[model samples]
Target chain A: MQYITSLITATAKPPPDNAAVFSRWFVNHSSWGVLMTVDGQGFPFGNVISSSDGGTGIPYFYLSTLYDPTGMNALKNSKSCFTLSETALGTCGQADPQFPKCAKIALSGDVLRELVSVEEDSKEAAFAEAALFANHPQLSGWPKGHNFTVFKLRLKNIFLVNKLAPARYVPIDDYFKAI
Target chain B: MQYITSLITATAKPPPDNAAVFSRWFVNHSSWGVLMTVDGQGFPFGNVISSSDGGTGIPYFYLSTLYDPTGMNALKNSKSCFTLSETALGTCGQADPQFPKCAKIALSGDVLRELVSVEEDSKEAAFAEAALFANHPQLSGWPKGHNFTVFKLRLKNIFLVNKLAPARYVPIDDYFKAI
Candidate 1:
C-alpha cells in the first residue's frame, strides 16, 4: 500500500474514443478506487480501497471482513460497483473530474470472495493475490489476525464517461478483448 | 475543474490523532471523491464527482440530475455516502490507503438538493453555488440544459479511520465545532 504523495502522469493514455482499450488501460494503470457495496441498511456505502486487475480486465481486491464494512457488505449482498477516475491517474489535464472529458468508469457486478482452498479456482486466486501484491506491495505485510481474503468483481456492466457526449457502456466482451 | 496531473502534497495535514479536526480537514482539503447512491434495484452505484465545503464542515456538490445517476438516485432515495481518502491529498506518505493510518472519512446522510427558489434557504444556496464555483471554475460554464443544481449532505454520521485502531464515529456536533 503505497501512498501517492503527488500526482504523476500515466506513461501512456489510451484515446478516449476507444472505450474498450481505454477502460482496460485505466483499470490496469490504476491501483485503487472506490468500492461501493450495499450496507446492512440496504443503503450504498462507498469505501476507498486498493484494487488490481492483473491485466485481465477483472478487478481483484484483498479485503478483511473482520475490520472492513466493504467485505462484510459483500458477504451479505454481492451487488457492488467499483469506480475509477482518470483524475486519479493524473491524465485528465485541466478537466474537472465530473467533466465528461476527464474519463470515469464504474464496473457494476457481484463481488464474490475467492475460495483459495478450492483446487479449481486456487490458481486464479493465487494470480489475483500476486497481482494485488505486485501493484500494492504493502498488502503482503497486512496483519493475519485481520483475516484478509481475496475478492473479485464479477463484472456485469462497464459504464464509462470520457467524451463530451453521453456516457457509454463498454461491452464486457470488448473489455476483456482489449487486454 | 482542475486536473491533478501531478500529485502535490497538501500544504498542511492535521494530526491523525484527532478525529473531529482531522475529519474536517480531510473533507475540506479534498476536491473530489466517490459519491455512492443506491440504484433502483438496490445496488450501490459509485460516481466520481467534485465537491466543496467552503470552509464549512458540510460537503456541497454541483450535480447534473439529467446526466448523472448519482443525483437521480439521491432524488429517489436520499440515503447516500460520500467518501474521501487521504491518499488523494497526497499526504499519506507510503502508507497503504486501506492501512487505516493513511486516514479516510465517510459522510453518511441524506443528500438533499438546495431549493434556490425558496426564500428561507436561498442564501445558503447562493453560498453553496459560490463555494462550488470558487473551487471548480468550469462548473459555472457547464451546459445549462443539463439541469445542474446545488446539492448538500445533511450529514448524519461521520466515520473516520485515521489510526491503526478501530475507526471512530466522530460526534456530529464535534465535527461542526471543528470548523
Candidate 2:
C-alpha cells in the first residue's frame, strides 16, 4: 500500500517597517550584538560587547578605539557583518526559566568614514552632539582621553527570528525604512 | 608654558564572572554584534539579522535554511567568530565605543553538526524536541515538512579584549563551569 504524505508550509510576513522593526527588535530583546570581521587572511573573528546608542528609536552605534579591535579590523577590511540575538540559557542545564536562545543577524557593508569629534565647535555641533551624548550618557566625559570615529553601515540584508513560531527576514531597504 | 593635558582613565574591573558578563552583554546589546563567516574563496560575508530566541539559559539557535547560504559557507570553511562591544561607541561615532567597551569576547568554534530530527533515546531528547517544536509551532502539524536544523557550535576559545585579557582565553570547560 502506497501511503500519500502531505506537506504543510507557512510564509512569514514582511515586518511592518524594516528599520522600525530592526530598531525595535534590537532595543526590546537584546543588549549586545556580535561584530564579525575577517582578517587579511580571511579567517572569521567575532567579539561581544554592549550597545552604545542602539534602542527602539535608533539603530546606529558609536564605536570607540579603546574597546573595539574588531571594529578596527573592520575599518581596515572595509567589509564586515554584525549579529544580535536573544541569549540561550537552558540547553546547558541552568535553572533559569527563561530560555536564552539567540537569533542571528549579519550586517555586511563598508564602514563609512569617521566624523569629526562631537567636541569640535560645540556651538556648531550642538544639535547632533547633544543628541548623541544625551542618548548615551556613557560618553559624557569620553572625548578627552579618547579618539572617536564614526562609520555608517551600508546595509546589505538582514535575517531575524523571534523563536516564536515562524522565522522572518528583512530586506536592506525595508530595514532602513522601518527605523 | 607647560600645557596640562588631562587624561581621564578608568580601570575596568573584570566582571565577577566572564560568562555572566558575556551572556549579559549579548542579551542587553543585541544590535551591535556581527555574525561573520568565510566564503568559498575564503572571503568573509556578513548580514545583520533581527535576533530573538527561546531564552534558553544556554545559547541555542534555530537557523533557517532559506537565506543562510553564507552561514553554511562559513561553517564549512572553519569555525566562525562573533564580536561585540559597548565602549566603542564613544570614540567611534556610531562606529565604535570605548571604556566599558574594554570588554569584548571572541567565541571561536566550528559548526559540529546540524540536527533536524530528535531521536527518542537521545539525551534530553524529549526536552530538546519539545523546545524545538515550541519555538517553531508552524511545524507542529507538519513535522516532516519543517526544514529547520539545530546546529551545534563547539566553542573553542573565547578571545576577550586587549588580546591579553585574562578572560580572553576561555576554554570550553571553563564555559561549561561558568554556567
Candidate 3:
C-alpha cells in the first residue's frame, strides 16, 4: 500500500497550464469579493460579501437579511456576479493588480438559497452550513432575529485573467475535475 | 509653516468612527474588485478589474477593449458598481471578512469615459492618468493598439459595512470632506 501510494504521488502530477487548476487555486485562496445583483431600481448594486469554497472552489456566502442590501437584492433578483483578485491573496508581489500577470476572476450567475435548515430536504445544505461556520465562525453567534441566509452562486460564466493578453473562459466541468 | 504643520497633525486627527475615512482607506488600499455592469443580455456581468484612486479617493481604471467585457459593457451601459473588501487588505487578522469588523465598501454609479486622454477638455482626466500610472506603473507600458481607455466610476451611492450592524450610507459630500 505504501509503495502504491508513492507510485501515484510520483506520477500523478497536475498539469501546470490547466486553466481550471488556476481558477480554483485563485478562488480557494480568496476570502471575499463584490457580490453584485440588480436592485429594484434596475441599477446594479455590488456589495462586499465574504465567501468560502471549502476547497471545492464553489463560492458560498453568509448574508444578513436585516443589514446587507445584497441579500435584499438577491431575493428580488437572483442574478449576480462575484469577483476576486490574486492581489487579495497577496501573491501578486510587486505586479500591479491591473497587470494581467497578477490574476483575477469573476463568477457570474444566480445567487440562490442553497442551504436552509428549515428546508430539511438537503444534505448539501447541512454540509454547507458546516463549511461556512467552519470558516466564518462569527455567523454562529449572529443575532437570531436578523434572519441570515446561506446562498451560493450558480455560475454560468467563469471569466479569469491570470496572464498577459486576453482572459480565459474556464469550463465548469474542467474546473470541477481539475483537482 | 513647520509649527502649523505640527499643529494640524496634532489637533486635526480624524475620528475613528468616521465612515468616509474608513471607506476611502479601504478602497485606496485595495488594488482590484469586481466591476459590475449590465451586459447586452441585461444580466449583470461582473469582471475582475484593477482600480486605483488618487489621494482624492476617486477611483481610476485602465481597461482593455480587447479583453475585459466590462470595458465594453461600460460603454453600452454606463451604470456600474465597484466593490472592495478589507479582507483583501490582509488587515482583518482573525476576524472573518463577514465579522463586520472587516470593512467593505461599494461605490455605485456610471463608469464613463470621463478620464480618457481623448477628453483633452478635462483637467481631472490629466490628474487621473497621473494617479493611475503612478500607482499602477505596469499600465504605462501596455500595447497601444489594445485601445486601453482610462475610465472612472462617477460615484452616486457610497455604501459601507464596517461594523456589526446595518449598512452605513456615506454621503458624497461627507465622503469628500472626511479629512
In Å, residue A69's CA in model 3 sits off its true spot by 1.0
**Runs in model 3 with CA error above 4 Å?**
A1-16, A115-121, B1-16, B115-121
Give the candidate order by descending lDDT.
1, 3, 2
What TM-score against the true fold does each predicted structure earn?
0.92, 0.53, 0.86
lDDT of 3 by residue, B72-130 (tens): 88888888888877776677778876677777788988888774444452666676676
Model 2 per-residue lDDT at A24: 45
Kindly report which residue stretches of model 2 are placed more than 4 angstroms away from their true locations once superposed.
Answer: A1-32, A40-43, A48-59, A84-106, A113-131, A143-146, A158-179, B1-36, B39-60, B66-71, B82-105, B114-143, B160-167, B176-179
DockQ of 1: 0.64
Task: Report the lDDT of model 3 for residue A31.
Answer: 69
Tens-digit lDDT track of model 1 for B40-65: 89888888889988777778899889
lDDT of 3 by residue, A83-164 (tens): 8877766777898777777777888788887544555525555555666787677777677687786787888888887776
Please list the C-alpha lDDT of all candidates, in the order they appear: 0.84, 0.44, 0.73
Comparing 2 and 3 on lDDT, the stronger one: 3
